[model samples]
Target: MAYYIGTNGLAAFSVINYLHAFMFLAFLGIGSTIQPMISYYYGARKPEMIKSTIRISELTVLSLGALFILIGFFGADFLVSIFGVASDTIADMAATGIHLFFLGYVFMGINFIYMTYYQSIGYIKPSVGITVFRGFILLILMLLILPYFFGINGIWLSLPVAESIVAVVLMVYARKGVMEQGTFERRF
Candidate 1:
């Protein structure tokens, strides 16, 4: 008998959580590079610099998302052909999963801006809170919600949907801050 059947379910959850953490880390490098620059420009109150950075980051992330989406859509068949799965249904399902995962990247780009906005103001707690909530709580909520209705497909869609919600909230908070008429002095 396979030993996994005897282990506590927590082990499986731990493994899954570790995988998620690894994936999150994989994106951190790019985020790290862009985040500081966003903050620097924002702190300096250089509206033009801030605008330029946001525009460039958005375009770059959009292009990356588009490339991945294209691969998942058009190249899905070709890539799956290499695995020797020998089952058309399996290949199709895999391709569908890939497509579903990348569908939310566009919204994710917008979310990045909001999250970085807090960071730019030297207010890291809010940004950290959003990231943690998105990675952990939002995922848990999705696990609960996705299974009750659309099954795995719901889980696949959860990330993008949750991210979009977070983005909206962050934007609202940011807008309020601007409306409240507070000013930040340049650190330099």
Candidate 2:
């Protein structure tokens, strides 16, 4: 990204990296809060309880995602300003990136919820697939492709775009599970 977009872009991305670390921590905390309860329900074979737990957790995360987007959108200037970049150009770049990059927060919550749900239910494949896809594959693909079209903005969009794609796939898979067997099973 730095290579494609230059030094200023790298500096802006550094701000994003810092911001994303915080987001990751919050997501991890949410996952930690939900995982144990879901795991217990699954172990006890309480499918209804598991369903309820997953549902509530998903909602909680989605709400958090919304909050994150607001922080990134409305607070973009302040958020970037906090970094004390010497150049207005860098600061503006970071602010713009924040607005674009934070769009992923909407989908990221559900992706984590699904990953947690799968892990809790002993379905390792989907969990791993979700992690690998979001963390590596989709990220790389989006970085490689989005830039070809959207230029610098595409670089900013890489994370959210990858996350949104994974979330869609997860939602479709979960919906299929609910429709087919009346509940999500330990499968893809």
Q: Please tell me which predicted candidate would have the highest TM-score against the true structure.
A: 2
The TM-score between candidate 2 and the true structure equals: 0.94
Off by more than 4 A, model 2: 178-184
Which runs in model 1 stand beyond 4 Å of their true positions? 1-29, 81-89, 171-188
State candidate 1's TM-score. Answer: 0.68
Estimated TM-score for each candidate: 0.68, 0.94
Q: Which structure among the candidates has the greatest lDDT?
A: 2
lDDT of 2 by residue, 32-95 (tens): 7888998897678777777677778778888989999999989999998888888998899899
Candidate 2 CA-lDDT value: 0.85
Cα lDDT tens digits for candidate 1, 43-132: 677656665666676676667656656765687666556555455555565555556655656556555655676677677877778878
Q: List the residue pairs that clash in candidate 2.
A: none
CA displacement after TM-score superposition, residue 173 of candidate 2 (Å): 0.8
